[model samples]
Target: MHRSGSTTHSLFLSPQHPHSERTKRRPGLSAFLCFLAVLAVSLSPVPGAAADHRRPAPPPAVTAEGLRVLPAVAPVMSCGDVTGVDLRRAAGAEVTITSAVVVSENTPNPYCEVRGTIAPANTIVVQLPLEGWTQRYLQTGCGGLCGNASINYGQAAECPVVEDGTVASATTDMGHQGQNDGSWAAGNPQAQIDFAYRGVHVTALTAKALITKFYGRSPAYSYFTGCSDGGREALMEAQRFPDDFDGIAAGAPANNMAVQNTYHHAWNVLANKDADGNDILLAGKLPLIHDAVLTACDTLDGLADGVLDDPRACGFDPASLICAAGQDPAACLSAAEADVVRKLHDGAVDDKGRRLEPEISHEWGSELAWTLFVPVAQGDPVSSEQFALSYLRYLADPNNPRPDFELTDLEFTKEAFWETMQSSSYMSAMDPDLGAFKRSGGKLLLWHGWNDHHISPQSTLAYYDAVRGTMGKHAVNDFARLFMFPGVEHCSGGEGPDSFDVLTPVMAWVESGRAPASIIASKIETADDGAETVSRTRPVYPYPAVARYDGSGSTDDAANFASYTPKREIGPDYKWLGSRLYSSDYQTWCRAEGTELVCGQHRGGRNWLSREAGR
Candidate 1:
């Protein structure tokens, strides 16, 4: 591992340093202070706790092979005793255990909170239950250009194991400490590699070693869960480190990173701007557009619910929303605004109209979340611009970084599209082959909100189709299943039942060989006094099959819905400039040589199609 110009000093204090040595000598005083800090963290209210709470529905009990119950016993050594467990030789790097304390305040059970760092950087936090250990381990992934260390299981709130705090969990900062800006990647190939895939894998190895030391054994089952960038990490684990986990739950993954940040997200803002730099579509008109779309296609699944079962089936043309002569601007869109909406839905294109990404960018019911790209006020930069500009400046081309790159320098032409794909092998997780993972008995539960405003749900659909094509549908079905949430937004939002649990289902599938047919999703409402209640519930089926109203009960209940497969297929092979990169041949294995990063094709083969296929 090359360490020149490393940010490790600024991010983490070396365990051998005087500051750490001094703290270790005064364990009594340090323990009390650390207890207070952990108490505050345990007591702090989680954001969106009321609105996002999933009503507890315990998974069916199962007695599967390899299931082990940890003996009921207290720690053989004191909490502070683990600080002396040197792991440098075992980890193949400098592993520092900064603090170890028992945290019980406002928690389901007392647990040991261990904080540490891997050589160079990579901060990690692992929580081991003090009492009942089910021999289960859960490692979470971070979002965006992860610069912060935090543990979030928002996607697995309904799982009894996680809610009860019996399962051990861990998370890492991906080797840097900063804001979401891509500044950490500049002049640092090691940090970039950690952020891409190494951080999560190293964290797993370190955490497992610690777990074995603490419990006298290793976990019986291991799992990984994340959304957005975390989702990308989940797929990366299955693709590159197949034995790291037994099950994975990925939601709205930004797996098509290189092209997604460069073109898909950039085009969202660039295509909506007029020549004078003013937004062609106003944010104020999104509600009206959403309502019009619902009026035109809401009942396609035989229910007039707020969500569209399949937004791709929606043929609600923007031209239908164009205003007549002298019509109120608030009531209908102008011709230019209508055209902008069309281009957005059609995704990014070259000068000759070749697609840069998948055909669909933003989905039909996702208009309300368009505030991500649609400017709220004149001269204000939209969210997508910041996301795209960061990648273009630091992570787009590994061989040539552009720290001074501006938004205006981004080109939507075919030549510029291939330039972005140059680093896809390192940053993106689009490879479809999961043979190694399947052979290891890993179960994958992939999900994306149909109305996801960030990464296109079509990308997930395309990857799922590719896996089936590569490994054969029957073989893939045994280990993988994709569920598309109709009215949900990126991760969880939009006017739909967004709260659900894939963790419990994946756990069952991996342990008991029982696959999920449908997962019930809920729409929760929080009252002013903080009382949370479920407003609606719907069953979300696997891809291509939708929840249709059964016609005899309340639509708000999941029982009234049944799975129905649609006649029209969702995503065929995408006709795009970077379409050839989806194959395994484009995947790369990268290494650090001196201070620079070098990469070579993992498959060492060429894409069957010409690199400039769409051109």
Candidate 2:
């Protein structure tokens, strides 16, 4: 079929309520007669029709009740007909059908795009192909407090994948509209719920029902995929609603939502500031740190290409970079500058000397990117400043504007720490155990860049280890696997090879039972003419297994490397507060695994909302 131009528009609000007008439209006289004639013959009694198991079933009809009939080769639904289709309540949500049309953006297939808003402020969009459907439904998740339904699932820059024209896709606007604004959650209980979890769950159920109506049968398999905030959503689907998807691919997940945003982001900003309150970490200093790290640890895995194969094994000390006697200011860090590096390696800690978060030591390569979150020059608010400000002012305290926030304003008292933890509990996806998800026969694939500057990759490792501790390593590995790229940053580009396909492997595992042992990742070099060439390729193994070189072969080729399991290191516990909020299922799983320490004991606590709003 010929492709059409891309189309997009907001949904049209009808005067009548959606639920009150479900399928009340009637076909014209000619179309009604035709439908009646077909219905009569289909309903006519056949000789032993119920017992005729050998007889072939009639050809599937391309039309359904309450749907405007169209040829399979034509647009899936007319704009006029789409606005008229009634969207009744599903999963206790009343959704308004706002806009619908067919979109074709230089693809082999055209698709019907449907946009709607679930009551209480959540928007969802679903796209179904007109032809070449593989009988599969794919729901894409959002990124970083999503306020818009970015249709960025199939061809995201971080983990680009070949799109299957037969697979349908959908996305949601996670409750509100702001590109990094957290003030929308203020005093809106239902909206907070929608952003945290309801938005995705309700969107999936609605999309699946719509797919059944359009294609005349339910999809054979369902899948979910996203990175960053989308990655958190993927884990949420597996943890909170296990039966929604058959497989999930999560990349660089911000799963520890509460702690990562408030505690971790604040810690990074403060660490970069000088004693005089100036942003001393300049862009010019990044290369020096990166080079020092590479000089010290690049050959740990038998290569010297400037990328750390496994940075956790590298024990580089920033104290070594302290300026010696008669050193140039440009070449070496002064005592004050060196202190910034030390705090970055040390991470967050309370006054009592207990660690609140793990150190992000692998961020040396992407130190320049850290400037985005924090101010690089005077008068510029750090990137995390606004996000943390909104979270604290609106979600944590409605009365105070919190206008005079300084880098030193963040304190780690137990009262303030628990306040941050308890306030955002309704919106986090930090639970570790996946017993219900595993029981549902779901498969999950997770990946993270080691040099990720946005969310520390170490946090992901901690969660993975917690999962192993809670459910046993073998049991967790059977249903979920995590792959780490050596120098990749925050789900996308870095010094190491980052581009790879997670969708194909997850699909194969779900449909054909082929679990991926090691997926080959490639870094493509694009020429001036836009011609792409694969410059490097490496096999990324599951967690705990590092890729080691064989004796004497082309180092660039993946065939020269083998998977080797490294010895686990015993480190200090971070004692993150969010881990104590898992459901009873996780507690039960920990008990069954003979790890009672994994179960959460502090189940009782003071209500966060009971405090003064101005605090």
Model 2, TM vs. native: 0.80
Model 2 worst lDDT run, 10 consecutive residues: 1-10
How many clashing residue pairs are found in candidate 1?
Answer: 0
Tens-place lDDT digits, model 1, residues 1-615: 001111121211222111110001121222322222122111212122123365645433443211223444445566777888876654456889999988877667778888889877888888888888787889898998888777778667556576667888888999888757897787777788888887887788788878777887777788999999999999988987788889999988888998778888888888888888777887888899899999999988788988898887789899998999989878999999999999888898878988888889988889999999987777777889999988888888765678788776888787677756765568868889999889878999999999999999988888888889899989988889899988899999889988777787777666655576677777877779766667887877777788888889798987777778877686546767776777778777666665576766766633433355334
For all candidates in order, the CA lDDT equals 0.77, 0.64
Best by lDDT: 1
For model 1, the superposed segments whose C-alpha errors exceed 4 Å read 1-74, 568-572, 605-615
**Model 2 clashes, total count:** 7
Query: Which 10-residue window of candidate 1 scores lowest in summed lDDT?
Result: 16-25
Cα-lDDT of candidate 1 = 0.77
lDDT of 2 by residue, 1-615 (tens): 100101111112111112110111112222332232222111212222133568866432322211112233323545446666555544355678787776666554566778887665677777777776656678888888788875665322222112335567777887787645666655454555566676787777777777766766666667888898899899887877788888899888877776677777777677677667677666567678778878888888889876777776677787788888989878888776777777776667678755566655335555545665545455577666665665655544322335455437778765576656555555556567788888877889888988887788877787787778889989997888888888888778888887666765665555544565776676767779766666777778888787888976888877788889877653435455334543322211111112111212123323322232124
Q: Which stretches of candidate 2 lie over 4 Å from their true place?
A: 1-80, 154-162, 361-365, 373-379, 396-407, 569-615
